[model samples]
Target: MTLYTFFGCLLTAYGPILSIFFLFIAKNAQHVLLTVASIAIQELFRWLYFLLMQRAEPGLNMVTKYPRSPFNRIIFAFVAGYGYALTTSLVSYVPILVESLGPGILMVPSFPAASTFFDAAVTTSFFSLLHMAWMVIAFDGFAAKKWVGSLKIGWVLASHLGASYSTLLNTSTIPFGCIYAMVIQIVFLLISVAIIVASLAKKR
Candidate 1:
């Protein structure tokens, strides 16, 4: 059950990743097509990145190994991701209160009617939490062990930092204000390091 929760989080980013790319392209049939394409592209990159990481550090390869039951993993991953969406959506609503206090503080972009500030915020948060869970599950499946929440925290920090850098520096489609992104990155890095230390201690 816990393992499923972890996998759920990691694989849950599919919808958000696809939606981001879809926002870049023209809004037509191409949007749907691009969303599908983004999924394929992301999966390709994920596997490729895993392979590269495994080569660099064979020990980490356990994190990416598929579980005993592919169907179970899939169902659990989606359920975990979707379940997290509820929490994320609630967190996202807080921004609305922020907007009432002031504008441009967050600066959400205009996309599909459904992808507005409220929707995006919720979805983003959902994926973030889900990915965090995914990392823990992957660790259990691959590492065949569990520890204090520290390791998951560290992994999430590393993943968040990498994702933010790619989105902010490489891609020009930053959805949040500069200040907000910086703050989030800082928090993510700190939490991630803490997680890593905890996991390491457990290992020792």
Candidate 2:
């Protein structure tokens, strides 16, 4: 979880800069594309995070030392997701908060609108939770020595892109889009939990 937090901070700190670089290079890059890229980068970081964790402490590998209960997996996923959300917000928004207090220092273009910060944070948090839930499912499959179907990168990417796009739309002019997005995310989370439970039952 601590490692996840650290990686979240790194993303929060550097993500905007990378986006700006893309903007300058692509000349006609759409904001939506950049948003998708950002989410994809986060997912990649998640993969790297688990890889490092598995390497640094083999016992920490969920694939080998799987949690015995579905509830435990849910709890672990929630905690990890919450940590990522909190650290990501702290590193990304606190600077903006400080800037709002006085003169702005960080000059990253295309920052999220101040009006949508609350909505974006809420959406991001819930989406992060869903992402972590999927991770748990993926890891559980691996722990069962079934790597073929463990990773669903496309599903993960699509869900994140959907969430981010929804948030962005809400930020623009679409009213209540964030609420709809949250509902979709909640449904996804429930489905993931149900899948995890089923997987645990089968294993037992």
Pick the lDDT winner: 2
Model 2 per-residue lDDT at 97: 40
**lDDT (C-alpha, whole model) for all candidates:** 0.39, 0.48
Q: Can you write out model 1's per-residue Cα lDDT over 111-194, one digit (the tens) per residue?
A: 222223333343455444444344333333333335433454345456645644633521235444433543554465456445
- Estimated TM-score per prediction? 0.29, 0.50
Clashes of 2: 0
Q: Per-residue lDDT tens digits of candidate 2, residues 32-117?
A: 23223334334456666445434533332343234344344333333343344444545655553433334332221233333333
Q: Which parts of model 1 are misplaced by more than 4 Å?
A: 1-68, 94-154, 160-204
Against the hidden true structure, what lDDT does model 1 obtain? 0.39
